[model samples]
Target chain A: MASDGHPSRGLPRSIRNAGWYLLLSVLSVAVLYPVWMTIVRALSEPFVYINEGQPFLPVAIDWGVFNTAWAEGVMGRSMLLTLGVTAIITIAQLVTSMLAAYAFAYLRFPFKTVLFVLLIATLLLPIEVTLIANIRTIRELDWLNSIQGLSAPFLASAFGIFLLRQGFMGVPSELRDAARLDGFGHIAFLRKVALPVNRPIVGSFVLITALGAWNNYLWPRAAVTEQRWETIQVALRSISVSRPERFNVGVAAAIIASVPILVLLIVFQKQIIRGLTAGAVKG
Target chain B: MSLSASAPIQAPTRRRRSSRVREALLGYSLLAPAFIVLGVFGYYPLYRLVHFALYRPNRFGNGEVYVGPSNISSVLADEEFLDGLWISVKYLLYTVPTGLVIGMLLALLSHRRLRGIKVFQAIFSSTVATSVAVASVVFFGLVNPKIGKFGDVSFISLAKADSALRGVALTSIWQNVGLTFVIVLAGLQAVPDAVIEAARVDGFGPLRRLFRVTLPLISPTLLFLIVILMIFGFQSFAPMEILTHGGPAGATETLVFKIFQRRAPGQISEGSVMALGLFGLTFVVTLLQLTILNKRVHYGE
Candidate 1:
């Protein structure tokens, strides 16, 4: 290091290093500012900035918003309902996807490739496009105003199967053969060999599926008809629409809706990052 | 090796019949639950939507009554439908390229090695965790007509110019910029460092290397990003619902909102048609993207 310390070389290196540090600090602030604003608004007195006409900063903090949001805001009830729906959908989709992925990845059959391609191709079909017809189907099943109406539609994700199949394919064939030689059946082999090895991918899918379900607004909005049957997202919309004047309350509701996701991010921040970036970057 | 070696020998002959049976039964059984759900929830509704789109709702409001081809012609002929489609197209034009450019820029800046870089990356993707409702709320407050930063600022509000559609679109771009940024950053990171280094060694500048080296390498990720963005954009509902309520006078009435508005709780037929219309639009976009980029994707480790 000392040998490379020519005066000109060190000068440029120091300058560039400082420049990089400065740029990163600026970006970090830009990223954190919105989150800080949300937190401030949530914790502060209702319409503090609006009433005072002061610059939008948290000068005073109040915890009443949380109490109000919990008691009067649709956050608590809708959140529980949303969680229940998300859990059922996630579990159902996971089981269905895992089994389908196992069959697709390991099973040998006529038209396997065709079936797999068709399955993956369905990913291109956005849920919105299918909503009109699916709604009708739900009505036909008399599923309206019920959990079955909400949870029945998205129980199988083609995208999940595709992701899991890729994970399964990465497992070595020797493992499968070893299971076979031990007189283990296909289900047992999958449980012993595939599931255990691909637990991380499975876990990632669970997180993704749950997040997708939890953040879901349109499908739940479309399916659940009754006001009380609303998901957190639908409830938030209702609150904002009804009380456009209470800017602080709306922000509180927004914060309330965001808390679960924030908690989830803190708990499973690693998995979310990995899941998001996996398709983009190589290890 | 020995297992494969054995695969071609005794196991094949001994287990062939049973394996075939096991495979067949397991294949259908595994698929059964999904297939039933898909059929009931997906395919069945698609059939009904198509069927209902050809019909007129009964005057008595009893149920959908088939009038055949006329309703389709009417929907096609409707000026409102045409305008809606045009508005949607305009939204894509504004959102897609702007999102990509902004996303790429953010990703490039944040993808570098710096102190607390992970935190910056998290912030960049934090929008993914924010629901549309929440994001819209933030923007709504910021763009408050009276007291908001942009609203009181005058210069920022001028671009909005009392048009809720343009206003909501601007807010949407702001809210969603983070999402596309995260996705594209992932794509950018997937580009190998070796390739970038080679380009640099060849005397290519940063911009040149980005265009020549990085862009080509990450085309698949870009395509994937675009498809996902476009789909979500088309399906976007809550922002329009919450921010403008599709209003001053139906300026932000998007495809999804239109479907929801057209159908009542049990009006499956009309709902299905609108839903199918959205599906058809997205399906075409997906196929177009695949066709355009399929040859360019270099699948490798």
Candidate 2:
């Protein structure tokens, strides 16, 4: 058996490979079929689609629905608004987390251990747990339907601090000594050395934070009472639910709402995966 | 020279002491922004939630009435709250294992050393793009009794009280498949090829190698996935909100949905109680996984 090219109790190598490929291909189709159907349904004329018994393929193509959904749903405003909120949250998380992580990883100060513990403790009280009170707080501050209410509660993330501290701790002590000897202060060292060395971790955190902020539903749904303040996710809901007669328009809105994040995922696929598994897979 | 050296050393000691104070100041300043935000928004609300649970707003709408721990007991005894908890548990049962198995299968399939495997991996993980809102809409359309692809499937009939949860669960499973697949695949990739090769040399078949060798090696990752998926299961709201609206009867009304419904002005106390109950449930489950299950997880030396 060792003398032959084939292994023990095995078919030819090509056949085995083919079998695996076939299985993988089938699974991929199963995974992708729903999304493809959605795309078809969104692009097809509803009457023709129903007339054709909702065949998998589009019977009559309509480019106008995308425009209609965009206008009717006020999706453009929501997209821009959501993008602004996402940017604010992402940038704020990065800055705050970096500052906190730097202190935890590199600085020595009073109550440092206590503060780190306090930060981690926030994880236990997710937004769901504190939603009723937070809404009151937002109302008391007169921040309802405002970006402040939308972005403030999430501006700082304990998970971000934890992830970043892990990354920064991996920065070599020798490098820190070298930076100090060169007359670099803490901020200078952080900007020039620590962040650059931990680019991938930072990148992962940024992508995930942006994704989370963009797709946020519950908070935005509760925070904003006005149609103008609605995020894309909430707006899509109104579009779909408010006009059940124009189902294709709703589907088109969903597709539009998803396209930006889909493009981000494709472009930064590696960073997204790394971010998601950062906790499970140690560096 | 001795006097000069002593003077210099004493002066440097004073300078070093002052510098330590400066360093502490800088560190505190760096930590201030995050702490303030977390305190006001994150920690304070937690305190307020507890306060709200124990006190209800009086009829004047200005002052609170001290109700003590009565709210907790009342909420606990409520049939709807209990039903919500049960539904949440059912949801957990429906989503977690199914997600784990599908994720595991997809990972194993794509973990092969074959050409164009990355393409398949991308397709498999593509659902990570679909948010809760998008997924709810997609599945809502998919499961519609008249226009849906699965309209004729008896088991997934949304109009039936008993089977509606299954429909919502199907949406959750599909939406979560990408995340589970990505994490599990990462775990599988982390397994060294040399170990698998050695298992083969020991005459271990693929299935035996997977169960006995590979699975044990990746048990830590599996545990992580399970905990995460469980938390996700409990947090699920959008699917129920959009697809079923807790429908036909109240079969799909998970705890989060119930909490959302209790958000009305008069029901804040009750909602706070329910919210705390949810927190307690999540806390206990997570602690169990980390404490008991963690003992069985394999961490290679």
Candidate 3:
């Protein structure tokens, strides 16, 4: 124990033990309010229900309105587009990061120290710093309104490389040498050894990257101006901005926008937190 | 703990020239694909921003007019940039402490040995699902002037010029408090049970145990949260753009938002300069954090 364990010198234990439970229950309601309302209004009829009974409650649920919102907002197309783009970015970044990390951890090269230092230093460079020039570059390539534009700038990440490198380097060199003696090439070793051992890191990084892509607001909005190429984030913004009258539809769009990632978070909360904090705690 | 073992002892492989060449080749090849992508996006864009900031590119991406570093000075003097900086500071003030305090409160409240405690923890952390855009839109709907949930339609803070920032603050806090909660919960969990029990044995009261023991023990995580929250807060833009479009006036525009929201065509250089300034700000803040908080943050045995 690092600290003195003396509980009796604090506030009355009886009051704390009794009151905390009630305080937590009440606090839960406050925290859940916006999310609950979003789902409720998303399910309710758009224009008519706002004017009618139980103004805030989710009674008179209507799937028809959500269906109409999906069609009208082109949310289905945009959602699919976002999903495909997210998947590509996630998978590509992982493969690329894995390769780069393996090199850093196991292979020898000239200026290896300099290269690693530079890459790590780049972690401090915020994406916003380069957004201006990058968007212009995207424009010059005629990549706007395309998956290439959406996925290109993010196909590699310093953060990903740094993370995978930490995990790969943590692996025992003895195990690696033994594998090589048994005729495992780098590719085979990575697939069988590195990937398998660091599955938590890989899994968590996938979730984080997927979340980033799904929630992309600025780049997607700025890069792809065409309505056809718009992601759901852009679509949701335009929907809410254009048709506050269609409030329920707007809420439905937001809900539909968030569901997949929400499921991922619920299922992989531990790994996601691990992935997020990996750089923070140790780096 | 496993980190101590990573000092590479070169395997007893052949050290001949051919083998060395092959090893180097393989290393570079592995690094090549990612380096190419990073070159195009990360390093290349950073280089271009510096170049762009030094010169004014014409309407076409082809020609350039060199204006030198005066562009940065001009941007610094500009009112919008200064206003954006102020807004950024205000956002940090509102969202950062509130999120930390609320999160710690949630953590402490649930750190009990109760039944189904995880259910409450999960609910508390559930807002992590709402992305910036999604959360901003949700808050927008909630506080919309008419048909809005909270304030009377006419008195909606989001619709007013002076109070729109506060409205955005609520959205930011709602989205971020979950993250703080999770981080703090992890920190609290890491505190050794023996420490708590020892405090009880020493006649430490409930609040004393918390103040003199648990909070101090968990301060490292809290400090870590502060660094992240400061960075995240300074970089906030999506809520401003999504919720208020940077205002009922320009009331909610923060530094990152200012970097992208151009009022004129030649403002790319200006925005680039501001972006770099924001980067400098981020680096300085991080340095400040490490120097200031390093003394107090506990590294447990």
- For model 2, the superposed segments whose C-alpha errors exceed 4 Å read A1-6, A48-53, B1-12, B288-301
TM-score of the second chain, each candidate in turn, equals 0.85, 0.91, 0.88
Candidate 2: give the clashing pairs.
none
**Best prediction by DockQ:** 2
Model 2 chain A weakest 10-residue run by lDDT: A1-10
Give me the displacement of residue B147 in model 3, in angstroms: 3.6
Q: Least accurate stretch of 10 residues (summed lDDT) in model 1 chain B?
A: B1-10
lDDT of 1 by residue, B1-301 (tens): 0112222112376787886776667777887776676666666666667887777667778766776776666665566566666667766766777777777777777776556767777777777778777777776766656535555554434234345555566656766766677677767666767777777679776678767777787777777677766776787787777776666567677767777777664454455555666777877887876664444434653
Sort all candidates by TM-score, best to worst: 2, 3, 1
Docking tier of model 3: it is: acceptable
Candidate 3 per-residue lDDT over residues A1-283, each given as its tens digit: 2232226436676665556668778999999988888778777765655455326577668888667778889988999999999999999999999988988887777878887867766656666766777788898898989999988888888889988997898777787777766878777888888889999989999898999888887788778878999988888888776677777888787887888888899888899887766533432
Over A1-283, each residue of candidate 2 has an lDDT whose tens digit, in order, gives: 1011226655888887787789888999999888888888788876664444567887578889999999989998999999999999999999999998887887666787788878877877777777778888999999999989899999999999988988888777677767766878677888898899999999999999999999998889889999999999988888875555577899999999999999999899999999988767543
User: Candidate 1, TM-score vs. the true structure?
Assistant: 0.89
Interface RMSD of 2: 6.9
Worst 10 residues of 2 chain B by lDDT: B1-10
| Candidate 1 CAPRI category | acceptable
- Candidates in order, interface RMSD in Å: 5.0, 6.9, 4.2
C-alpha lDDT (0 to 100) for residue B74 of candidate 2 = 90
